[model samples]
Target: MHTDARVLNNQSLIEGDICIIGAGAAGISIALDWMNTSKKVILLEGGGFEYDDKVQDLYKGKTTGQKYFPLKASRLHYFGGTTGHWAGMCSPFDEVDFRKREWVPGSGWPISKKDLDPYYAKANETLKLGPYNYEFDYWRKELKDLNPFPLDDKVIRNKMWQYSQAHFGDLYKEAIVEAKNIHLYTYANVVDILAGEGVQHISSVIVKNHEGKTHTVKAKHFILACGAIQNARMLLASNSQAPRGLGNDHDLVGRYFMEHLEIASSELWLFRPFPTNLYSWEYGVTRASAELAITEEIQEKERILNGTASLLPLSVGKHQKPRMETWQDEDPRKSSESLFKNWSEADEAAKSEKGAIERAFQLNTRIEQAPNPNSRVTLMAEKDELGVPRVNLHWELTALDKRSVRRIHQLIGQQFGIAGLGRVKLMDFLRDEDDDTFPDSTNGGWHHMGTTRMSDDPGKGVVNADCRVHGISNLFVAGSACYTTSAAPNPTLTLVALSLRLSDHIKRII
Candidate 1:
């Protein structure tokens, strides 16, 4: 039987077979998986049914590393979590993202891509995505027939398109409302954990509300889907009983923080012009044979399979401009408008400006960042109103990260020229000869990842092979944070797959 906590008043504590934190993509996916199970499931979300600034302020922190858009009231918090602002780009991780590359340090996942393939179909069904096949033939019909994107010229190459465009809240709302065994509680913020002897087991979780009233929930298993940053923060903040924090025995809970370093505001002018009408048809759909296809054939065939990367084609106005800002004016009422209006107010000048070359495609090359311990999210001395310590986001990159970016630039440029897409110019315009001159020139993609990575070794990573905290018997993690490698593809789809996989694992445990 499921109960709506929002309808219930204060001091409401519920017990279940499993308790999931954060009702975003990860949590909802897992909840749906066990909806008909015999076990009682309780899903606790920090925010209420709607978005609010008072709760959103809980995610604010001191920014570091590259410049980033301030944590938006829209970006960080709420009932649905960050999925509210997500541009539903869905692609699976490259096979290389699972392998342990000798060249990249702290690499390799406890489970391979094949290990998770079975769940991808269910993931697609949950996300309202297209068919299951990832082969190029699936997307052949969607091509404009002029010629395949230059990468297609390479005989071993495989390309895929956008498979799923969905909002988690809307997609899963009806099912959740009618779920038989899942209890969803909004406005209940989990603040602490009560652990058993030796801190190896979790007894129950402590949650609070705006009224300062609290409730404690006991469950056989606990999974934190509160996103990459908050997952680490919660574990570190629960340091009262466990001195180094829960599952931090190796001092490795929040280390090795990383985010994709994206180069943007760049343009790719067409060598041969194509029809403008194709934009609507080709924008985003991913089935192996639909409008898009991406496969690992090229990297494997060329023996260049150390790390992962993806090529994305964005439609832009005929004329292209160089400048890209941290934020855009998507919502006028949002803080981004006030902070970024100066640059956006000048959009009229930007559009009418002369000497601009018409662009055919806006290509963004997102590559993997190898884990580096120096790049981390440490706990701050100060605590929140609930006494949970804040997270000090210390995201950093390594020399290998720069190499991957440079190699991607060279490969994309060569492929564009070969495929007659015109010579691709980088947004970060460093000459090929001056590659090693400056490393920090690239900008943050804001696609944050790592920090509490999943690995086979308990000593080196926070979560074990199945995203279970090593010593902690029933605690698990889901989301981009568990990613062993921050691959080039958009992580939304892969994260959902992992979440679904976690649910399957939980079913077996029960």
Candidate 2:
């Protein structure tokens, strides 16, 4: 039931019970749930099964405010989406990430962690993960000689991470093609969403492909499972009915963007060799990494955002160079190969000097940036091959983001001093309390989130608790775009879980 949209007749109307756009992790997960069901599901992908430079160039645009990766290189526009090159790091959002914090602006989700608990377990199966466990003690019992740093729980605790090798395009392609009730259309890019009377319901979606073919997809329900940036861009671009864009009356469609502040902030010089395999990266099996995180109690006292710092061997970290500078190729595969080569060389160099290395490591910070409305994705004047406006990203970081990183390391340094673990040398940028500017080395996890944030109040968010667009009945938005707050962990797990939850809601209604 899978076909290339270019092969279909131009201006043909393809009707279905449900239409899910962007066959990425979220879109594929949702489509799988409806397999063999009576509902006729149509899934759309912008690109073919593999990478195409022409399609990737559609993602290129201007980046203002904070320096960022080239928009074209930041994301992959293939069937699997960005998961094609994902590092497989996965973790659920903490409970505190859902609750409102006075310090973080536009923080809090309408639903709590408990609400997504069942779906997270279901998402684990979809992700081909080991188990639904993230506890440090659980991993400690499973892993031999696995021990944590001697630190107070009130001050610092271990944050667990799990890895998944499932590439959605490769793993689920056969199943998707074989599904009787599901029809997947590759190279079908949704250029506009045609709205019905009063812009309350979707009539159909205008789709185009590079082959110069255009068609229409009509469905009872529509779910935008495209990644954060494209989801916002599409909503902002479909301005035929609502004028300001469909369901964009509040001017909140592409606002409140958030990303995890990933930076190598400091060095941890331990007094003795820390022989533990728990934190090291492992594949094909479940493992947990220890990250020094400040407790929720301390966060309330200090009024700072949530953050975690993981340790890496100094020998390995010192050799690790920035890839953005040299990775100028437009094709993601070439860039990925270059990055892998660099990491391989660095790993070899680190191993060669391993015997002479002292008890020292590097501290890397992964922190949540407070939601700022100014940080957004707006439509650029330049149009892509499909004649749709490209996205212009204005990624903004707050002073609180800088302060939190400095404070977290300072607190960790103090605890290390008290426990006699060793001494911590703060990075030059963090040493200056008055310096609010981030260094060029300061980068994000490349995790895009929070543009179409969910909220109970229509005035605040593009979608509601059910992920349905505000004032729109049959339209829903899936993926990290609906995330209210981007947690320190990667957004894949939580976003897939939320997609499953949305699927359940759709089933209940239909």
Instruction: Compose the digit string of candidate 1's lDDT tens values, residues 1-510.
Output: 334454565666688889998888888889888878788899998887666666776766655664444433325565666666565666677677788866667778989989889887788788777765555555556454423454544432443535465777766777876888888887778888778988888999988866677788899999998888788888988888998888889988778776665554235566765543322233254233221222354444433323323333433322222212425322313644453454444444455644433344455445566688877778777767767777677656655655555555556666667767677666554455445333433545556677788977888888987889998899999888888888766677788889999888988888
Q: Which TM-score value belongs to model 1?
A: 0.85
Off by over 4 Å in 1: 1-12, 72-74, 142-146, 150-158, 265-270, 274-324, 328-356, 359-362, 418-421, 426-429, 432-445
Q: lDDT for model 2, please.
A: 0.88
lDDT of each: 0.67, 0.88
Best by lDDT: 2
Give me the overall lDDT of model 1: 0.67
Q: By summed lDDT, which 10 consecutive residues of candidate 1 come out lowest?
A: 315-324
Q: Which stretches of candidate 2 lie over 4 Å from their true place?
A: 283-286, 326-328
After TM-score superposition, the amount by which residue 443's alpha carbon in candidate 1 deviates from its true location, in angstroms, is 4.5
